[model samples]
Target: MPELRITTLIDAPLRTVAAALLDARLLARAVRGLGVRISGGPVLFAGATLDGSVGPVDGTLFVTRADTTGVSAELVGGPLPRFTLVTDLLHTGGGTMVVDSVEWSSPGGPFGRLADVLVGRGLALKVLEARAAAVSARSVELLSARVVVGAAIIRDGLLLAQQRSYPPEAAGKWELPGGRVEPGETDHAAVIRECSEELGVTVEPDDQIGPDIPLRADLVLRVFAAHLTEGEPEAVEHRAVRWLTAADLDTVDWLPADRVLLPALHPLLT
Candidate 1:
């Protein structure tokens, strides 16, 4: 089977750009009017589903793997059998570079090549563009939230922490200030609101920490930098609040889900 490749440059930060591509909900939203349905697992690399029409032809594509590095999808049990498409994402300076390749082996030799030339390239490119647009819009949406935001409040090279409110499930473990997403609210807004309601202090959502990192179970956390704007840090919803430098991060008890954000947050703070 021969491979066909296509590459394009996207004008956005790598991590931010990558988050957009990894989100299945964002993909579905971006391809809304295109007669397509897209869905995916919680984590980026888990898997995804794509179903819809390309021009007059209908097909379904299954993403076997997707992450910050790349996305791989196969056209299984579709109009075109044994066709596979893979998209790789790379960080380039302040933007993201996307490369997509398609490969297939059909019994109808020469005729297959001709079909690929006539239809495959165009269809593949359209899907890539749709994916990119979805990611871009989602990034902007996360950046525009006013309340309930993901936060990593660092002081003197250490991140701040709060003990979980709920017991057994998330009890006793320390975590970044944030909470469940509310209806009609952006992830960033949800984080900000969680901080305010839990800490009894106003926090300003500042910079983004990293890509939308997914937990082992099902939570997708969009981390951001937040600054304390009002009130002393008080234990309202949580058991306690403390500041931990990079060196102290390992010492404090952390929630299992929030562990994913540490890798990305550590380097920035320390």
Candidate 2:
């Protein structure tokens, strides 16, 4: 087996590169011509197995390990010998360094070895570079430039907290069920939109609580005090919803930003 290593520089933030790499579907789209598909029937957790084809070569792309910062995959079977690809992302002074390494057997036996001696390494690496670069350099402007909102609904001396269902980092953590504030939309409007979209209810905002909290460089978190206008709160996008008294506040695993408002929330619950 022969291995080829290539490192490409990208002028984007590390977070942006990391976010792009973690999205398997986006990767499939970015390198669609390479015939890589995440449609591996069913995937387990943490990573995906991609089915792909290049030239006379076809194989299942196995994800051995994957995370925000790095990922490793192996291309196996088909007309080609088995090989693995390892990719890493790191922050550099200018921007980010994406290191891509591919190690694989070419064509197979005698005839295959002959082919490799001719142009196999070049051909194989050409395809690998195309695929890897697709993942390394897609624009991440949209991912970083986003803002979000949260709602704190207090009723009957209890505060409502919903468990997040996605973004494994915040999964199962208690938070207010609100989403991104739309363009030209007020925080109150966003609270209503999110409550209706996420919790299946209508709410009227009473006042703003705490202060604007930064979720990221470009994302902001805002909390609002509101009362249900109609319909009881239903867990739409959340894993579960619970109303807890002041005594239960300290015990609940509130999401980090939401936890900061616990003191302010205690007064409203009373």
Candidate 3:
């Protein structure tokens, strides 16, 4: 069997580069303009699959093993007769470098051998390039943007809180009554809409608390202080809802990001 190898260096920290390589969605985005299709397993490990097509030919590749030291993959099915493709990822002092190699034996006889000589190197390089692009795109996406909104409904000296009951992302955690902002709506409008939908209470547009606070990942979070006008807040989207005093903020498990708002909220509400 003959082998084809290709290597490239990426200018990012090892951990950052590793994470992008491990994420399937990030990998897909990096190779966006390419006509190739790609998919992978839940985690970077043996038995995980990466299936895709280049031009007219389709193929499925599998990760045989991966660890802190390195990672490897094998090509299962493709236009070629028989082949195993392996990729190794390593951390260098300056950045991470990825090297991909392919080993294969001819299917029939001299004709297969000649075809391997013509196509193997080209195929291996195409796969390596696609993988590299995917990793880079994922890194950029994760670092790009994030946005969150929190609601503070204060009556007397108490703040309103809700316990979410949905997916792990939203369930079992106590948070202020707001969500992501939608397109074409003002922050104030989004807050009012969220309060009405989540708590079943109508808030005047003027009741918004203050300007949005910027967070990591280009995220902007807006916290609003509004009054409950018509009815008591019910748990429509959450498992529970309660009015809490400034002292009660410490008792519940608030989201880590929202916890940053507590100290400032304490003095203003109390």
Q: Positional deviation of 52 in candidate 3, in angstroms?
A: 3.4
* Residue lDDT tens for model 2, 129-184: 77566755443443445657788888888888899888998888998878898998
User: Model 1 lDDT vs. the true structure?
Assistant: 0.64
- Best model number under TM-score: 2
Q: What is the C-alpha lDDT of each candidate?
A: 0.64, 0.68, 0.63
lDDT string, candidate 3, 217-236, tens digits: 34545677777677778888
lDDT of 2 at 175: 85
Order the candidates by lDDT, highest first — what do you get?
2, 1, 3
Put down candidate 1 lDDT per residue, 73-151, tens digits, no spaces: 7766655556776768888875788776767655477756665764455655566567666656665554433332467
Least accurate 10 contiguous residues by lDDT in model 3: 208-217
Q: Using Cα atoms with residue i matched to residue i, what is each candidate's TM-score against the true structure?
A: 0.49, 0.51, 0.44
Candidates ranked by TM-score, best first? 2, 1, 3
Report the Cα lDDT for residue 17, model 2.
63
The CA lDDT at 155 in model 3 is 85
